[model samples]
Target: MVSTPSPSAAPGAGAAAPVAGTGPARPRWRRRPGWIPAPPLRGRRRVPWATSAAVFVLQQAGTGFAAHNERAAEAVGPDGAARLLLTLGPLLLLARYRLPRTALFGTSAVTLAYLAAGYPYGPVLLGVVVAGFAALVAGYRYATWSALGMLWLGNLLVAHAFHRLLPPGGDPPGSWGTDLFMLVWMVALCTAGELARVRRAERERRQRETAEAERRRADEERLRIARELHDVLAHSISVINVQAGVGLALLDSDPAQARTALTTIKTASKEALGEVRQVLDTLRAPGDAPRAPAPGLDRLAELSEQAASVGLRVTTETEGAPVPLPPGADLAAFRVVQEALTNVVRHSGSRTALVRIRYGAVAMELLVDDEGPATGTGPTGGGNGLVGMRERAAAFGGTVEAGPRPGGGFRVLATIPLPPEEGGAPLQ
Candidate 1:
């Protein structure tokens, strides 16, 4: 059964959307609208071991401080209370990093309470920032914002009330640039976080665009190749079809001439069929379809006979024997001959043609010449077929020549370079 391609499966199914400011369009990776960030790391080790270590050290410091100065440390409850708060800070941070919504808000709440009741402001703020930053980086938006708000608002109130009481002794509000410095620092921190987030988003956007552009280039190349194949098949098939119809029309009226025409038609039809199959096979993807062996230089004789059957008096000359050509070179030689024959019936408008293959030490040359019009007219215009043949030859490092012969007919001449197999210079 012929499998028709789906219209929806056509190339460019879901085109990428417009990019910011418009160069090429951008493809969206995530199906959803919001940022679905990287999932948090797993395992016990993924926990912030460094923060855990710091917490342990703080607990030790607090204990040592209390032991070193029981009266003074107890008076302010610095050693005992601060040590407990600092040690617990990392445990919370570890939990928060691993589990955003849960440990995160809990840590923020506990830290705020500890901070207001004489916990070290520096340690408390450090823990809050770390936890909040984790939430941001992980893309747990609501969890992070709420946590930061709670921590910062608590700090804001505490900072204002103790604006002059920070050092524990009464002092003027202007000391240490109190309100002004704090305000500037908070704004700066917020700005930095936003910028980092933007940079990350931009990077992701660029990555998606690059992937889509590569796919487009590949699709365009495939289409170009398809056009080439269609051109070849269409031109050859048209000639074959015309010849077959003429042969059938004269079948009983003129048996001898009809036989000749039928032979030519058979030859042309076979060549056209082979060429069509080749083009179709090329269009199939690797592993998507099983392929027959490709026609190459080995099939030169068959190609020549097909042309001869079409009423062209054709011949070929070979030299230097055959060499093992790279697969691409072999196919190019075959295609050049096929197109040259098609053009012979086309432009030369002749009943006779000659083909020659000269394999030298360096390069291989193919030449096709057709007798001028039976009525003695000049050869027709060299069409896109001629140009296409030349191009195909050139792809395998060959050059082509075509024009009416000074002797009165059209000729297509080409010399294709051979790749070196051993320590010899490559054919030019």
Candidate 2:
């Protein structure tokens, strides 16, 4: 699935809409327009063998014609079998893309043989050069360098073997200037091939890094959504479940109390649905306005009221000078209190819960305690509530300790660090 980018989404804002059924939203730049011509639906297009054959014929014919017209004085024009052999040398390049190493070695060997057989060094060198480039681009570094070495050695051997075939007063075999020129030529070709290879390798490395980064980002987003779902569903469903049970138990005996329970259940379910909707809205088109602000510490009183309706009395107290907190830290603290109190109602068998919030110089601390029997099945015992609390605190460079109180009940303590800037400002 491919999602079109919203025109109003800011570049690099990561505001692209996620494609339905796709795991994560792809970057806008990676999305191409539908009208752009795509590659063949089948596999990659095969090499044009006929075009290669035509090029080879033209090159050989041109080289032969140039040599016959005395335009290439240094070239020893080959005749009969020698000419055919020289022509066949470059023909090996037809399979260069598919069989790079083999083509490179074959072309190099054939070119060497032709030169050694006293044939002219004409356009045949073109095939060797192309093969070398193909091998380098295919990442056959050792093969390319080795072929180049052999070619240089063969050039020297041929020059020595046919020294008498040279024009009058020509540079002799192993001449320093001639050797230097040949070395420079070979090095230049090798350098060009190496540069191309390096560029291709760098591009591939960057692509791999990008893919890994995207995968990690996707994993983090999945975990974040899971945490939000757990918090919303668990607390609301637990409240509804308890309220429903209460409503059923008192349906006939006490109609008024049962009606209250049903009302609580309805309210909790509606709130839960709204929060879930907000989370889902994140997947909407990027141009949409942001959802409502997340639930935070200011909602603590409201959360306590909800717990009270579920038969768990919660008292919230704040110590130290009140200070503003970052949204994430505030939300984490709120969830810790909310989850702790929900456990008190559902598992701790506690009648009353105390939630303490302390603003310290370096950290904001939260403590929730209930004087209930510790033997009940509470959220602290192998439940995701405690795990989620720890995850939340840890996300903000904080820590959470949750367990049974030594006296009779359960306790949850969380400490979230306050960044320097946030710590400096007191709540208005």
Candidate 3:
């Protein structure tokens, strides 16, 4: 089982780990203590060929310069084999991105062998530094640590235990101060590698979070558009269906009435088309002003007229002085009332509905009632009308209660909380 950090541990302690078959792990802390901040890497693509060539040229020139100095006189001068060893380290760096551990170990081994051969040191260790950094960033923290440890151990064995077996005849045992300095440099390099690993992990995590947030926003917008289309189509189609039935029944008995029914159907279809086109325009060019203003409670009279044309008498009554509402609340309230009355026309045996609007100091209530022995084939809970009404009201921190009334009718009540600016003086 993989062990995770405790709750009180530092943030990002449990970043993604390397999977099996990718690399070996020790199952301890991946990010060591004492973070040293590294600047963010600018580019993603690793030009391994370019990097390998650059490092090889720089190391050859740098080592030659160091060899000419008097300080390296005690060290063995570069020869054919020493130059070959120096070349090997940089060549191994070509595989650093794809196989970081391989590059690190190969470079470290070649550099160690050169030191064991008693060659003057300069930029020869550059390959090991670069490979170790890449390995840690690739989530091979333990492997990097082990490779570095082996290099340090190899240095100790060469300076003390295996010096006679190596080159530079009559050399003294290495000083403790020199070993201490090398140790400090290794620790610093490892510290730098750990910092880079953590920073890269953090950057990747933030990118994933940003992408997830965008996905959720897209899902919500799609759902909102779907609800809008459903509301628009359901009511308009119900009206058209009723008018078409009336026109069919009256075609032989009353031609004028049949013509009237056809006109109603035409008007309903035209309005429905206009609303659908407006909704579609939002998709084609979002953030542009809508070609038509959205429908709201101010259009309640128009809604009542549409219902009346289909043999449903809708009586509307206002209890308190009305105040302006936010655009979202106004649209939601209108849809709730529209869907409620649509349900009445399609499902209820009674041809009447009563709509009541009451305005309070900080809330607006809409109550739609229809006397009914539900006669149509529509299912009460299986349709989208009630669900859409509830979702809309909930979006504005409101509630929708829809069910059978206490006595004998179906009722839908939506209570929407008003924003502070829209909540006028208390109603009397």
Q: Could you give candidate 1's per-residue lDDT for residues 103-197 as a string of tens digits?
A: 66776776766655543344345555566566565566565666666666666676566645554344223324644554465456555655666
Q: Record all residue pairs in model 2 with backbone atoms less than 3 Å apart, i.e. clashing.
A: none
lDDT of each: 0.59, 0.72, 0.79
Each prediction's TM-score versus the true structure:
0.50, 0.80, 0.83
Query: Residues 13-67, candidate 2, lDDT per residue (tens digit)?
Result: 1211111011344467864321111223253434646645765776678667766
lDDT of 3: 0.79
Output the better candidate (1/2) by lDDT. 2
RMSD of each: 14.6, 12.7, 14.8
The alpha-carbon lDDT assigned to residue 193 of candidate 3 equals: 82
Q: Choose the strongest candidate by TM-score.
A: 3
The lDDT of model 2 is 0.72
Candidate 2 global TM-score? 0.80
Error of 1 at 296 (Å): 1.8
Q: Using lDDT, give the best candidate's number.
A: 3
Worst 10-residue lDDT window for candidate 2 reads 13-22
